[model samples]
Target: MDQLSATLLSAPVLFFILGALAAAARSDLAVPETIAKGMSLYLMAAIGLKGGVEVAKAGFGTELLVALAAGLVLSAAIPFLVAPALARFGGLDRTNTGAVAAHYGSVSVVTFVTASEVYGNTGFAIAGFMVAVLAMMETPAILSGLFLARQKGGRLFAPELLREVLFNGSVVLLLGSFAIGALLGERGFEPISPLFRAGFTGVLCLFLLDMGLIAMRRILKTRALTWRLALLALVFPVINGAIGVLVGTAIGLDAASAAALGILGASASYIAVPAAMRLSLPQADAGLYLAMSLGVTFPFNIVLGIPLFRWIAESLGGML
Candidate 1:
């Protein structure tokens, strides 16, 4: 609990909370949209390059394959498990529940980025291939959500689902950059080292500033999120984190890698999934999922879940 509290009060998380507060207070301060977008691109590219460099050093192996496969399975399975419970307990209709559950099952790159920072600060080493794993995990839950929605006869266009799953901005940029980085290898990365390495954390800070503003804005818009929904957001991540830890342990992940996996599982997708939901599940109230995701789950994972998962993973690793 002390660790959790410390994490919650960490500089990045607090800055995010401050951003939320500023938004709640309706402050005029804002990140320019273009600059925000540019920051996102830079972060994605740099992270991809870094991951590629690490992979070059480590070389691809069975652990990477196993982790990737586990990520895909989790991404596909979690939404099916979560949607029904949300529908019954939260009073979300089939379509809305499915949409929301999909986001929960998907990866949040920003949250992953933050977790990596937390791990680094704590002197834990994480796998370089985890970034690729993160990218792979983004879309399968979306596909699952669409399948579940269709089973209920929800009105969704096939093209819209395709676009959402394959062409979403974050998905495209993340995978595209990962491919570029993998192709470039060590020699290529050296020339781009200053661009990808030196500027990474600074760009992340700026992005979080924007995220803080956005989270704050969303919180204000949904001022009275129901206890049921809020509780769902909080509890679901714990459950997901547990599953992640188990998988990570089985795959022989070290403490830091397991913690990072826990963080990924616990984090909800706010950006890509929301955009997809808006297009694919138009009848579903954006307020419910977006609020639960950006407003509730994202903050919870960053402040509380990161440390808690890290501790749990460490304890479990020691026992093993």
Candidate 2:
């Protein structure tokens, strides 16, 4: 309860709540799209660079390899678990189900970022290599979604879609920044510490405020979100997240890193998966997937799921 209260009262989360409230009240307060985009870019770059520096400090190890492998398995396998539930219970067709399933399987960078902030506030130390785990988790679910939708008859591995999934701007920026940071190491990172390190949380608060606005607005405007699908949206995070935390712990990650894995598992991709689904599974309803991921799941994960996963991680760590 203290942890949850602390999370809700934190600066970034408070700003996010303010944005959501403003949007819900139909206020005209807004962040310009261009500036929001820039903030997003900045957040991703900072996260990537920081992760690289940490990996440089720690060096490669068995935990890193096992964590990456665990992440990949979760990303690829989760869609299969989600698809049948969507088909039977959510009333989605094969393509739409695949699209939605892909979302649950993929990670949300913003959610991860927000959770990292909360983790830091609670004195949980996320390993640097977890960023690589995040980057690696982005795309395999895409392939799985394509496979799930293949029965609908379009080419599964279309050239453009593969390119889009692999070279998505977020993926490119994160990977590029990570490589640069790794090359620079601690000494190189020091020169730019004022920008990437010192300024990170402030930028994240702003970015999350914009996100809260977008998420609330999306929920308000969409007609496609149903109660059943909405329930699934909330449910997936808890289940998948628990599984991720346990897997991470089983693989010998510390509590914080395990919790980080849970955060990634809980997140759904509004940005990358939506674009890929449009290209590959064009028949899938954008409004449905977007509403569920961005509207329902994103907010829930950021607000409640992070702390829940942290507790779960801590408990598991304690038991071991």
Candidate 3:
């Protein structure tokens, strides 16, 4: 309860609520789109770089490899469960159902970022190699989404999509920055710490304000998110997140890394998955997937899921 309350009152979250409420009221308060985009890149870059630096400090190990394997398994397999559930519960067709499944299977960078913040606040040491795990998790879920949708009707393995998934700006920036940070080492990161480390939360607050505004607008305008689908949005995260944490613990990850895996498992891909879906499953309804991911799931995870996953991680981590 204390953790949840703290999360609600956190500056970044408050700013997010402020943006959502302002948008819902039809107020004119808005951040510039360009600035919003810049913030997103900055956040991802900083996160990737920090992770790379940590990996450099720790060096490659058996635990890192196992965690990555566990992450890949979850990312690939989760869509299968979600696809059938959407069909059975949400009454969605294969195209829309698989598309939605894909979103849930993929990782959300923002959610992972928020989880890391909460994890830090709780004084748990974060796993540096999880950023690599984050990048690895994005593409396989996309492939699974395409595969599931293929059973219905849609193009599969389009050359363009293959390129897009690999080279998407977020993936590129994160991987590229991670590589750079890895090369720089501790001494190299020191100069940039003032920018990337010191100011991360302030930047995150601004970025989330824009995100809250966008999520609220989607909730208001989109009719695709039914009550049934909305309920699934909440349920899937808890299940997937728990599974992810258990898998990570079994594979020898400490509490923080396991929780990071849980957060990734729980997050839906609003960015990469959406882009792939548009090209691959052209018949899939954008409003449906977007509304469920951006409107229902994103808000829930950011507000409640992060803290819940951390507590689970702490408890389970201690047990491990």
Clashes of each: 0, 0, 0
**Candidate 3: segments with Cα more than 4 A from true spot:** 151-155
Question: Which window of ten consecutive residues has the lowest lDDT sum in model 2?
Answer: 149-158
lDDT of 2 by residue, 257-308 (tens): 9999999988999999999998988889999999999999999988899889
Off by over 4 Å in 2: none
In candidate 3, what are the lDDT values of residues 182-255, reduced to their tens digit?
88988999998999999999999998899899999999998878899999998999999988888877787888
Better by lDDT, candidate 3 or 1: 3
- Mark the 10 consecutive residues where model 1 has the least summed lDDT: 149-158
TM-score of each: 0.93, 0.98, 0.96
Using TM-score, give the best candidate's number: 2
Ranking by lDDT: 2, 3, 1
| For model 3, the run of ten residues with the poorest summed lDDT | 147-156
CA shift of 118, model 1, Å:
2.0
**Which candidate wins on lDDT?**
2
Query: In order, what lDDT does every prediction score?
Result: 0.82, 0.91, 0.88
